[model samples]
Target chain A: MAGLTDNANAGAGRTVISVDAMGSDRGPATVVAGIDRSARKNPDIGFILHGPRDELERLVERRKSLRDRCEIRHAPDVVSMEDKPSQVARNGKGTSMWSALESVREGEADVCVSCGNTGALMMLSVLRLRKLPGVNRPAIAVLWPARSEQEFNIMLDVGADIRADENDLLQYALMGASYARNGMEIAHPRVGLLNVGTEEHKGRAELKLAHDLIAENAENANFDFVGFVEGSDIPGDTADVIVTDGFTGNIAIKTGEGTAKLIGALLREAFKFSPLSRLAALLALTSLRRLNKRIDPRRVNGGVFLGLNGTVVKSHGSADATGVSAAVKLAFKLGRSSFSEKLAARVASAVRVPQDDETSADSNGTTK
Target chain B: MAGLTDNANAGAGRTVISVDAMGSDRGPATVVAGIDRSARKNPDIGFILHGPRDELERLVERRKSLRDRCEIRHAPDVVSMEDKPSQVARNGKGTSMWSALESVREGEADVCVSCGNTGALMMLSVLRLRKLPGVNRPAIAVLWPARSEQEFNIMLDVGADIRADENDLLQYALMGASYARNGMEIAHPRVGLLNVGTEEHKGRAELKLAHDLIAENAENANFDFVGFVEGSDIPGDTADVIVTDGFTGNIAIKTGEGTAKLIGALLREAFKFSPLSRLAALLALTSLRRLNKRIDPRRVNGGVFLGLNGTVVKSHGSADATGVSAAVKLAFKLGRSSFSEKLAARVASAVRVPQDDETSADSNGTTK
Candidate 1:
C-alpha cells in the first residue's frame, strides 16, 4: 500500500490509462500482465485498472511492477461479450467498462482502453463522452499493417455505425488523417475512399458524393485525397488513411485478418510436412520469427474511437497480454501527444469551413 | 492448314470455349499460351479464340497444341480496361468480348472465358446472355481458398451489382449453392449470409429478412443455412457458400487478395534478409513452393457469372498463362457438367416456390 502511494507520486506527470480488465476473452490476468508489460517498458505510463476490486487487486499484487504503478477501481459488474450495446447502454452502471469510461469522462485519465464487447464499449463511449462538435457520426479507426514507409495505414468507421453519408465519410477522412498525424506521426496523411474499384465513375452514388467531399476538403484539412481506392489498397502503399462506411470497413479488416491467419496456418503446416522441412523451419527460425513479428495482428491491436469527445481504444476482445500491451502503448502514445484535443481542434476547424461554404452556396441558390 | 481440319474433326464432341483474347492485360499471346496449356492437359477442350484475325492467328500458329485445337473469330475491336460498362454495353458490337459472348448465346460454345475488365464483361454478359428466369440480379461467384475439406468456399455477388435486396440475396444463395454442387462436387452446401456479426439480431434489416428466408428454404433447397457469417468466415470452414451484396463481397475478396499478397511479399523479404536466411530458404525451397502453390491466387483464378442465361468465367485482367489456364479449367469443368442448365433449373424451381408462397400469404392477409 505504501509502495502504491510512492508509485502514484512518481507517476504524477505520466499518462494515466483507464483500462477495463474483466471483459477480455483471456480474463483479468492477461489485462494485468499487459499493463505490467507496458509499465515495465514505459515508466511514463500508469493505470487505473477497472474490474472486481478484490480480484484485480490480487492480480496486481502478484506483479511488483503493476503493484506500484497501478490503482484498482472497484467495478463489481462485468460487461460480457454477449451483452447487447443497447442493453448495456441503458443499464451498464457499475460495470468495469462503464467505470473505465467514467475515469476518462471525469478527466481522471487521458485515454481509456478496453477489450470488452465492441458494440457495448462504443455505445457506452458515445453516451459518456458524446460526439465531438460537428461530427455527425463518430468512427472507429484502426491501424492496418501496410507497405508504406510508416508501415501502417489508418482506416475508419470499422463498426461504430454501419452507415455513413457524404458528410459522415468526409468527417472520417478528417478524423482518420488526424489519427495518422497524431498516432503514427504522419504530418500530411494521404487519404483514400474505399470502393470496389479505383475508377472515378465506379461505386454507389453516395460513395461518389463522399469522394468529392473528401477531395474538396483535402487541401484545407492538410491531407492529400487519393480519390477512390479499392480494398487491395487498404494494406498497399496507396494511402496513409482509408475511409469507408463501417459495414465495408468492418468486412475488409475481418477478411484481411482471416486471410492472414489462414496463410500463417498453411505456412506452419508446410514447414511441418516432412523431416527436411521441419529441419529447415528450425534453421529459418530467426527469419520466420521476424516475418511473424512484422505481420502479427497483436502488434497493431487497438481500434481508436475517432470523432468522440474523449479517446477510447478498443483492443481485440480475444487479445492476449501482447495484444493488450500493444493497445495500452497506443493509448499512452495518444495521451502523451494530446490526441483527443488535437483531433477535436482539427475536426472542428475543418468541419466548420465546409458548413459555411454550403450555407453560402444555399443562400446563393447554387446548391445541389 | 491441314492440321486445322484434323483438329476440328478431332474436337467434334468436345466443349468449345469462347475466349476474349484481346482484352487481357497480357494480350493475345498469353491467352494463346493459356489455352495451349489447357489443350495439352484436357483433350476434350477446344477454343473459339476471339481477337484480331492476323494477330491471334500468329500467336495460335506458334503453339502447336492450340493450332490443332483452336478456331479464330475475327473480333477487330478490343475492349480496353478503362472502358466504362455503359459505354461498352451500348456500342461494343465488334469487340472481342461481345464476339466471345455471342458464341455462348448462339450455342456455338459451351462457355465463355475472358480476362477482360470485370464491369464491362459483366455488362456485356447480361446484355448478351440476359438474366436467367426469376433472377432479379446476377452475381459473380468466386472460389476462395479456405480451411474447408474442399479447400475452397464460394462467395458471391462479388461485383455484378453493388446492391442486393433481401430477395436478391436469396437468389445468390440458391446460385452459389448450385455452383458449389456442380463446380466443387459438394452434395449439400452450407450457405451463410455475410454480415458485420453472426448474431441473428445483428446486421441491417434486409439481412435479418434474408436470414429467415434462407433458413426457411434450407430444407427444401437441400443445403444447410448457417445464418449470418462475418467477413472472417469467408475463408474459414464455417460455411461452404457465403452470400453478400456485390459491394461487401467485392471489398472482402480484394482485401483478402491484398492481405495475402502483402504477407507473401513480407515472407519473401524475410527469407532474403540475411545470408543464413538465404541458405535456409534454399533448404526449405520445396516446402515454400508447396505453401505457395496452396495459396497461389492463380490456382483459383476465375469469377463465374451466375444467374446468366449462359456460363461466363471472368479471369483476372492481369492473368498470365497459369492464371488464364486456371480460368479455362474452371470454365471447362462447368461446361462439361452442364452447369448453366442445372443452375437455371435450380434457381427457377427454388425461386418460383418462394414467390408462390409469398403470393399465397398475401392473398391470405398474412404478409409482413
Candidate 2:
C-alpha cells in the first residue's frame, strides 16, 4: 500500500489525502478538527487542505497534530451548496473544490475528500479527473449499515445520474463489486439488481435487460449474481452489493435514513414519557450507547465516487467532526489499497468483451 | 360517516367490509380472528368474508364475535402470492380475491380488504371496479408513521403501477391529498413530489414536469404544494401527502420498513447483551411497548388503492391478527367516509378544467 503512493510530498510511508476545507455546513474549523482527530490516530497520514490560506493556517495552528501533517492550498473561492453542477463545471476555477480535485489529478494526493455540494463535487471530479475508459456513467457508492457479517453493504448510483440503461446498470454491478472487494475487502461480492420484486417478470423493461446483462458478466467480473433483490435486501444478507439507477437508489437511502431517524426520535420520546422509563433509560445507557455506536451514521459517512479516474469521497455536507473523520478514514483506506486503479481495471475488463466482439466481427467477418 | 354505507346487509349504522379470507400468509383462521377482534371493538362494522365455504364457515364459527357480524361468500379458488397480475386479471373468476372485489363492485360492501399478491390484487381491482374518470394510472396510498401532528403521512403509487408519467403524478397528488383528507381527516393536506432531493432541479425530467403540474393543481385540488420533497420528508412534518411513481415509492417504503426492522433487531440485541441490560429491559418494558406501538408497521397495515372506482385496502400478506385488525380499522374508516366517492369527485374537479378549456377552445376559439 505504501509503495503505491506516487505523491512526492507523501513521505516514505505516508498517504496524502486532498481535502476541501470549505463548503461543509460547520465550516473549516470542524474540518480541521476532524483531520486533527485523524492525524492524532494515524501518524502516516498527510493532508493537502484547500481553502482560504490565512483562515486555514490559523485553524491548523490551533490543532497541534495537524500542524506538521497539513499543507494548505490557497483557494479563495468557495462553492456554495446551491451552486448548479453545470455552472460549477464551466467556471469553478479558483474554488476550494476545484483545487482539491487538482491535487488528485496531479498525483499529489492518493484520494480526495470533500463535504461540498454533491452535484458540484461530481461535476468538478468528472471535469478534472475524467471518467475511466469504458465507463459510461460514474456512480456514487455508499456503505449501508446492514445485518450481514461484514456489517455493511455497498449500494451504487445513489445520485450520480438520474437514469441508467441496461449497460449502465451492468457497469454499476461491476463497479459495486469492485468497491465491495477493495473497500470492504470481500473476496467475491454477491451482486443483486434492485427491483420492485425478486421475480423475473417484475419491474421495468430496462431492469429485465440489465438483469440478463449483469448475470451474463457476473462470473467474468468475479462476483456472484444474486438475480433480483427488493429494497428490503439492501440491508439484508441477501447480497454484498445492491445495484440500481440513481433515482431509485437515492430515494431508498434517504428513506432508510429518515425511517431510522424517526424511530430513534420516537424511542427517545418513549423513554422520556414517565419517571420509571427515564430511570430505565439511565440503567440502559451503556447498552444504548453500544447500539448507537454500531448504527451511528457518522461511523460510515463517505459516499465514494466509482468509475472515476481518481478516488473521491463525498462526506455529508452536514457532517460533524466524527463524520468528517470517518470520511477521511474511508478515503485513506481506499487510497492505501489503490482502489481507484483496481476499479478502473475491473470496469474496463468487464466492458471490453462486447467492444472486442464488434471489432473482431467488423474486421474478420466472424464473431468471437 | 355512518350514513355513507350502501350495503344492504349492513345494519342502519354499519359499514360493511368485504374481506378475502384466503391468500394471507397465515390462512383463514387468522383472518377470522382478525375480523373477530374488529367486530368486538366496532359494533357498527360488518364483514362479507370470501373463501371456500367449508373452511371459512368453520373458521368463522370458532370466532364467537364474528358469528352474527360476518357473512360468508363462497369462492373455492385462491389467489396465491406467486400469481401473476395478468394471469389473475384474465382467469381469476372464482378466486376469493375476485369474490371479495365483487362484493364492493355490487355495493354489498363499502370497502374491500385483501391480503393477496399486490400486483394481482391491483390488476383484479382495476379489472373489476375499473379506474375512476381522468385517472390514467391508479395508485396505492399507505399511511407512513411520521413526526407530524396527524401521526402519519400519506404516500402514493406504492406499487400499484410501476410507472407514472407527469399527468399520472398529478393524478397521484390529487388522489393522495384526497386520501389524506377523507381517510386521515386532514383538511387541505400538504402534498410533496418525492424526488432525490428537495431542490427543483435535482431529479429526473418527469419529476420537474410533475413538480410544475402538482404546483399548478395544488390550489384547485385543495392541497398545499410543498413543491419537491426528498425521501426524508416522507416521515416528516413537511408534507401530509407524498407523491411519486410506484417504482420509487415501492422501494422507499420497503427500504423504510427494512431499516426499521433492522434497528428493532439491533435494539433487541443490544438489550440482550448483558445481565444489566436484561434488567433494564424489564424496567423499560412499558416504555418500549409504547414506542413499539407508535412505530409498528402493523399498526398502519393497510395500503389503500386510490384512483379506483371503489376503495380497496391491501394488507401485508404476512400480517398477523393485530395487523389484519389494523387494516380492517383503516378500511372501515374509509368506508364510513365514502372515501372512494370523495376521491373520485376530487380528481374529477381537478382534471375537468384542462379538458373544459380544450373543449371551449375547440368550439369557440377562446381560452378560459
Write one digit per residue (lDDT tens) for candidate 1, span B1-368.
54552245434789889999988888888988998999999889988888888887777777877765788888899999889889999999999999999989999898999999988999999998999999999999998989999988999988889999999999999999989988889999999999998878888899999888887667656788988998899889999999999999999999999999898899889999999999889989999999889877799899999999999999998899999999999999999999999999888777755445543435432232
Local accuracy of candidate 1 as per-residue lDDT tens digits, A266-350: 9899999999999899989999999989877799999999888899999998999999999999999999999999989878876
DockQ of 2: 0.79
Of candidate 1 chain B, the 10-residue stretch with the lowest lDDT total is B359-368
Where is model 2 more than 4 Å wrong at Cα? A1-9, A62-64, A354-368, B1-13, B62-64, B354-368
Q: What are the clashing pairs of model 1?
A: none
The structural similarity of chain B in model 1 to the true chain B, as TM-score, is 0.93
Q: What is every candidate's C-alpha DockQ against the true complex, given to 2 decimals? A: 0.84, 0.79
Query: What lDDT does the true structure give each of the candidates?
Result: 0.88, 0.88
Categorize the docking of model 1: high
In candidate 2, which residue pairs clash? none
